[model samples]
Target chain A: MSTFRRRRKTPCGLLSGLLGVIAMATVAAQEGPGLGETPSPEMLAAWDIDIGPDGSGLPAGSGTAAVGETLYMTNCFACHGPEGEGLLNDRLAGGHGSLASEAPRKTVGSYWPYATTVFDYVRRAMPYLMPQSLTNDEVYALTAYLLYINGIVARDEVMDAETLPDVEMPNRDSFVIAYPRR
Target chain B: MSTPEFPEEEHEQVAGNGLLHRRLFLSQGAALLSAGSLGLMTARPAAAQALDPWLLTPGLALSGYGERSPFEADVARTVLPVAGTTGSGASRTPLESLEGIITPNGLFFERHHAGIPEIDPERHQLLIHGLVERPLVFSMEALSRYPMESRIQFLECSGNSRPNLASTPPQESCGFLHGTVSCSEWTGIPLSILLDEAGVSSEASWLLAEGADAAAMTRSVPLAKAMDDALIALYQNGERIRPSNGYPMRLFLPGYEGNACIKWLRRIKLTSGPQMTREETSKYTDLQRDGRSLQFTFDMDVKSVITSPSFGLALNGPGLYQISGIAWTGAGRIRRVEVSADGGQTWAEAALSDPVLPKALTRFRMAWRYDGGAATIVSRATDEAGNVQPLRSDFMAANGPQVSYHNNSTQAWAIDSDGAVSNVYV
Candidate 1:
């Protein structure tokens, strides 16, 4: 118990209140809805995923910033922005000089470390439900479109195999190397 | 309280909101059995029993074929409840309630940030481009012909834990905390063969895996791990891989973090290094003591905990309850599991479900009897490499505040006099 988080000072009350307080604390700490309770362990393997910075999870599908413009305008525009600018969906890109600035801005071009990740997320779990329902081509295009909307890619630039990975994200070096070995 | 052992005793209650108990939703017609034939007077009993008529849908004996779970009586779920913000994703599977190794494929639990996709396995081709001398596209059939191997393994989501999942009375089932991990005998082609076919370029240091699932789930795995023990799985548990288990194909990185195993996999692009994504950056990274985040810490460090005799269970005077649960690790295999009814104060080795394959969920059981007083039950697992699971206290002391992900800390359950079980962090 010593190593556990130091117990907060108990609220002042009667002596008998202590047992009730502990019981209540224990009750509150049940910590789970305790549903099926079967560790299944089998299902665990089914739900894991990794979305890369470059959006590696992006499917074979492709999409364009224009189509992304239409999709964004319809579904995401309300949350992201009119043209991927900072708004409800947060900044899609930019913040070029905000890395070390006081107000650290997390934009696609400035803070995002990889382009594959944008594709991965957009495909794997995006639009939330109906996840991965988008055609692979659509994900690639949406990735391209998002990049383009962030001013990272040119409007007419076809975002496909040849151009996708080469699209250097601003945070390429923004992230320090993880998994360092001694 | 002496209810005999027949699954038909299955509880059938639908909460006002439509979140079936995960399993209850499976046999929708199971409860439609007429009690009049069984000589029961109550209509409620008739509404909850499985009749011989329903099991004949595809027949109880599934010869040379896989069948959807006959036990999904309570699990007619579309998606997990989204309880406002502060939540990333959480989904529950039917575990404690499930029997046997192979969980019905469709009833398999899913946790997608985006959504599931519909792929025409024919039009869907896995493109192995980038940093490869020969960029090849293998149709699902072509890949199936490659040297195939099968594995009984478990995949565990890094963030699947219930350390702070509640502020109410404890949940009465074990599935909530441990259901995020499951095991399956997945058969697939060796990625090494595919990479060899693609003729990976020498400069290729990282291999990026992508899935068709929305969120276009992607992750950058080291080329070494990629070529070492990776798989391009095509089938799971003797059937064509279920659409959710990546269907046409998925990249299975054995014994590594679950996210690295891309589902609905469609492509593999060899690259230079870790491509930090939202999963690698904004989430999944462990914030350590010195304000540093732990990354690339891949192998689910060998850990195990008893799942049964866990929270939300009723003691029923505890004469002899089988203390059983799962133990596993991304590091090789589980060597041994020890259970303690007294919270590790004393210990005894538990029997492991045999063929304890590497990177798989090894089930373990030990008979435990309660002295009829307040008591704590805990289980610890040791892997083949001799890595032992740490105690909750030890974990708390070393790790400090736990993160939302990768918590394999030892779990304990305390039984009260009233026969209620709750999570015990001790």
Candidate 2:
């Protein structure tokens, strides 16, 4: 790789090589001749729980808005309010036509460009109090309910990994690559 | 009311001839004493006079560590509350009270998503996996054994001057308006060293840097950036990094937005493409006029802020004053900083402090004579790349009023007849 070749020309490479030799010698004198331990696949998987936009890491689960209503009321209502209008926390519904307005209310329906982001955020961090406590099915149901309330999907439409990424959000075409341009 | 404390004979001697003799003798002695004391005072070196009283007296001897003078009050980061819990807010550096280009380790700005996590260095491990030849787990001790590099750089929140975009900007101190950014000398191991040790695969194009905080805040950095100037920072201002500033370690992206720096760095997972994390998509992305949000808007544009004679500072019937501020650019070194006393009609170059490293804050100063009339003072920065700071109006016209991040427009501060300063749009 070019990155590897470039590393040799950098000052960091020269210093690291010198240090690596000394570190290896020190380790050999003590226990063994290695810098770090090899990480187990299980250990990596425990923390490697990131879902990509292309639906790479989504867990298998399916639910409809009808099933999500009860979960939303119990788990999400206190913060997001009934109908997802939002009260204590961020407003998830409405703001569809407010993007061009002077006072833009950037909600789930108004600004978020990707549908997978909603699922990723809700799964990684949600409820404001208890995070990562929702089951895969519960996350799917909540995602469907949020999409339904935002007028992106029908109330009875079932959402799973295959169907969730296909749902075209209103602002899907709103994002443009900013870096490497200016 | 009670007066008979002295002996009758002593009182009489004091009041009578004895008093006259005592006065005469004391007058002669006073002259001699004054001469001797004056000689002693003049004999001492000029440098000795500048020493503090504690330094003059033999205080505590050398110890394991040193501390600032007790007389100096602890300058803390100014915390601004936002929605959510206390940890979900931001704190700014007291830029007005600081000197030199490097911000003190403690006063550096802080922005947390969920909260700061208490991590044990012994238990903490930084995993370098995903598209690597060898998936390695490094302990804090092991990480320290690697070669280290130190650099002076500026880290700024993308929303540093977000309030300036407001229709009515807050009448606050320069530190409050522009303090969300800070410059520091950071010491750390170049990430390329570790990445090379793991032997990064050719297919990896992006690296997801995740923090160990409660939020587990994550941002996808381009592989080129990670290998370029990025550092796994361990020290700030030559001391171990503060707990609030990521303690054990943090990823330092030279000129990128502060959020991408990822405090309390725990993992670096190489991938083929950006993960499009919640932070990059929902929050840090910038909105434009055509309703098209700009994604991966990393570079902070050229910006300058007048620290002195800024908002909240009252100039007392001004004569001649030294106007000072800091100017920086994410692209390169600041080439020039121009100050405007009568809005933008007239401009004067400010003297820039030396050792103006690229991507570091450059301190600039200028001398001004105030006529005591109403005037608007501002500073505009021009970077080495020839990117000049834009006007607020021009910036708004292009980015739209709804845009909230990456605003590097020139700031104007109006001076009233009473010598009071306020943030204003001229």
Candidate 3:
């Protein structure tokens, strides 16, 4: 947390220094027409919704799996099955060790590499019928329920910004990046 | 040596199964009629010709936005919405019915995660933040101020030619099976200039690009690519981009998979590592035969398909026909495209058309003299990087049958004795 704070602060100091250096160096030659405006924090907050694997940009909200289950039944059960076995939409749970099988069922527990993506995707594009309608707390509960159903978390465990980032997913170590190889 | 008095045989086979030489058209255009080998210019009984009604009458006046001929009503994109969703699917370009390399703006293939968002360019703003000394936001008017460059490039969905992976060939048209790829002239500002203006931090290695659509389609692109040749494309095919193809602006990464070019591009945040977004991790990744999926497989490998004389495009008692097709490579220009009349047993080089630009579709043609026998014709393209389109068996062996993305194998079209064409595994 201290490192994150320091990293964030260093950019501002560096930016001020960059302004002076850029004025002398004429960095505008490389940069295109300087017409872009510096976005305010509130403007940034409205559109900056992406959550990285390390829990960056995760909103402040908490929900337990028990609460998540109720939210799931009400919001997600129509498309995603009751236990996330999948019906009209994507299956969100189970398929823990099926990646190597003849017919791999790539559900959340099976192929996804990060737990934060569960929260990120559910918050942004879930329910299929009406997306981006869930509250941050409701999104947290739904994500918690999915994790619990996938057997990655306990039923009573609380999922928030702090604890969600620490949930080590099953397929976290299975990915192999194919670009910019050394 | 003295010139021979006798004319050379116009129908001489260059390769197995009646594959004529590339110069057959030039050498025997006038002679083909006298020899009666090609039925293209046979003499017919002269009769009094009647003028058509349109020739005698005045044509309709032009409209604000001109449209194609009403006679060409059937030549439209094949829309395939997902079973449960309205707009969360793809529409294929009509490859077999079209000619030349440039896909018309309207007929361009579309793959949307959510429905096309109705974005007012006046209201939309692009934000560039994270791992940068200066976080900047550019509106449409501001973005247009920057100098731009245009290049003719091809964008292909990794899932194009997916039907070729099946054990038995699918009896579908070339467009239906492999129409998710299209080429266009994209004009846009270079992303490197924007990144430079934003003062990218040296620690950043990846960029998370997000769209403004309901799905908020997101993908992580390597920073090196952004600094190399990525574009903030606003105009496509000499006009403002269509709404289905990301109207206001889109991230156009030349030669990369189509999905990575986020439509309705709204945000680009620099990061130290990949965000492992849903599209990259779970959807677009290539699952191999060993059950290990290959992530960040951006390059859409070398591929080719014979659009004409393919399935559903039957020949009329084939005497002479020009086998035309489009060949492309994600790495660079297509160096060579070879057509096979005998289904890969023998190969003959096809004549590439003019303006063979890098990362753009190259049109290839081969003259053929059919003997009215059953035959399988296929095209094989080799890119500047020397990457040849893999054989079907070889490609299938590398990636299992279940894998859907990045199928760039050679496609074969079987011509029966009745001059009927059908998709076949040769």
Least accurate stretch of 10 residues (summed lDDT) in model 2 chain A? Answer: A1-10
Model 3: DockQ vs. true structure: 0.38
Please give, for residues B295-361, the per-residue lDDT of candidate 3 as tens digits.
8989988999999788887776756677889999888899999999998999999878778999999
lDDT of 2 by residue, A12-117 (tens): 8778767656654574211112366799878987888778888878888988898889999999988788988988678899999887777777888887877787
Q: Kindly list the per-residue Cα lDDT of model 2 for residues B1-426, writing each as its tens digit.
A: 111122232222211111111221123432322322221111344456565887778887787877667655655667876565777779998886676799987789999887777888999899999999998899998877766778999999999988887888788777788889999999988888788778899999999999887777899999999888789999999999888889899999998999999999999999998888889987898877667788998998999988877776676663434567899999989999888888777676776877798999998865454656787888899999999999887887777877898889988988898878899985
What is the per-residue lDDT of model 3 for residues A92-163, given as tens digits with 9 covering 90 to 100? 888877777767788888888888998899888877767789999998888888888988899989999999
Worst 10-residue lDDT window, candidate 2 chain B? B12-21
Could you give candidate 1's per-residue lDDT for residues B1-426 as a string of tens digits?
Answer: 222232434432222211112232234322322111121111234455666776677745647855455554664322453333122355556565554345556556566544456789887777777688766666665554455778888787776665432333245455676666667888977677667656689899997777775566677789988778788888887888876677788888887767778888876778866767676764556544433446666677666766555664466653434555788888888898877766667676666756688888787755443445787777788998888888767765776342446767787887787656787676
Q: How far off is residue B229 in model 3, in Å?
A: 0.6
TM-score, one value per model = 0.66, 0.83, 0.91
For model 1, residues A1-182, the per-residue Cα lDDT tens digits are 11222223346656435754575466422111111112233432333344444444333445677776666666566556676676634577667665454344556666566677676566556664356466767777678778886678887677765567778876565444556320
Q: DockQ, per-model, please?
A: 0.10, 0.37, 0.38
Give the Cα RMSD of candidate 1. 19.4
| lDDT score of residue B197 within candidate 3 | 83
- Candidate 3 — which residues are off by over 4 angstroms? A1-30, B1-10, B25-48
